[model samples]
Target: MKNNTPSTAHLKGTRTETAHDGNAKVWLNGKQLNLQASLKYCSKSPTGFNWGYGGSGPAQLAHEVCRQLYGLETANLVFQDFKWRFLVTIEGDTFDLTLELEEFNVGHVMPLIETAEDTDLCETQNGPTGHGETCYFDADQGL
Candidate 1:
């Protein structure tokens, strides 16, 4: 029996920013995001944001912003499960920051396959045996 299963795959992409007037701006999927402005917004929120003293803070903020902007569950899962490296610049100062996801398990579920087809539906008479019948196969039995 041949197994056809989808495995967890890495969804990776890059976000690059150019420094201008002490701020860095990046265009992601045609949407422009300002690094400094996002950080400021997060910081000013009532909950408050800390880019941690250890320097992992900015990267976390960036990931969260990306997740919010691009609402894809799979991409968000990858972001939360993988370490991401970001290149940020501030007033000519460049920082290479690494962000790691908290340990967690992603449940795997077998996908349902639809093998039964309506063989009664045929387009042309040039089918098997010139009978205009569609053929369906049972791969497991090699029929």
Candidate 2:
């Protein structure tokens, strides 16, 4: 049998690199985000990978992206099939969520994120989500 799926880079570099200056340029909702201003720490477990953030800006972007993609009314993080999924609710009483996975290509593992929008809650405003939280997981953690 021959493989025909497109190559994807997810969680590239050694585990140490994840702890290094890991940055990402995430594109969502028609905008490009440059995150990792305060590169905290990234850990990989059986479930998937989790990264911590510093500055408020990075936190906000991650929060919105996660909520919009996960259809979460509050804030939550889940994992499935070696992929990390974030859930959050937007300001307009709408739900959203984000899913992230590592794409491997030879010697590269890059992250690929996808978002899902349920409804247009553009006018909803109740403040940001997922902040001031430190997450820890096991290296062999699986979902």
Candidate 3:
């Protein structure tokens, strides 16, 4: 069986685990989740990843986590909130955030995804936004 969970539509049992040693590390299922994909869209932290704060590194992590479980589109939709909600709360160096995607009610963001299907969720002029940046998705108003 594969340890890492790749991005897909069926992400019911997927899990995202983040650990902080000297730096941040993200794991999907039992394997490490890569950050290159997320960075391709928007490079945040080229050195490494971090959490417990609303910053570039955390934003990169948020995007990667969602991207790993879902896909690029969905990751763009929810990564901002992901950084604010879960990542920022991770305090201390020895933290483990095992997010069971399904149990975490990731489906709640589906409405936003549906809206995304009709309208482009990433409506930023500069591209995907980082933490504390304007993560708005709309023609007029935004999220």
Candidate 4:
């Protein structure tokens, strides 16, 4: 049978290169990804986004990427795993990470992230939902 999933080939076009001498940069589909959105969602990482380690900044970065590429709903579902898999794995002082956004999307939707116990995700002023102390999910909600 032929494949029917959306093509991410368009997403493969990336342009994240920046002056490495300064702060680290992340680009998606050939554009710079700013920290403003990330900060608005999660007030952590006042200094800005970072990766190669587990921290608030990485969490924000992961959240932002998932939020932008997929949507806030999916971001809440897959961000923690996204953080561990991509952001935390990026290393070095001057690293430019360009990833296949849809690859994350294809593997991480629906049943995989359908349960709250599976995600350990919570709601906070600076967290996913930007509400309450903890957030829960309705598995039937679907992606």
Indicate the worst ten consecutive residues by lDDT in candidate 2: 105-114
Can you write out model 1's per-residue Cα lDDT over 35-96, one digit (the tens) per residue?
44543322222222222222343443444443443232222223222223322332223333
lDDT values of the candidates? 0.31, 0.29, 0.57, 0.56
Ranking by TM-score: 3, 4, 1, 2
> Which tens-of-lDDT digit does each residue in 28-100 have in candidate 2?
4434423332122211221221233233333444443333333222222322212222212222212223333
Q: Could you tell me every candidate's TM-score relative to the true structure?
A: 0.26, 0.23, 0.62, 0.61
TM-score of 2: 0.23
After TM-score superposition, the amount by which residue 127's alpha carbon in candidate 2 deviates from its true location, in angstroms, is: 10
The better-scoring model by TM-score among 2 and 4 is 4
lDDT of 4 by residue, 37-128 (tens): 56666554656666768977677667777666656656665778888977677656445445554665557754444443454433455335
Off by over 4 Å in 4: 1-22, 97-107, 110-134, 137-143
Name the candidate that leads on TM-score: 3
Report the CA-based lDDT of candidate 1 relative to the real structure. 0.31
Shift in Å, residue 87, candidate 4: 1.4
- Compared with the true structure, what per-residue lDDT tens digits does model 3 show for residues 31-53? 67566655676566665567778
What's the CA error at residue 92 for candidate 4, in Å?
0.6
RMSD of 3: 7.4
Q: What RMSD does each model have against the real structure?
A: 18.6, 16.1, 7.4, 7.2
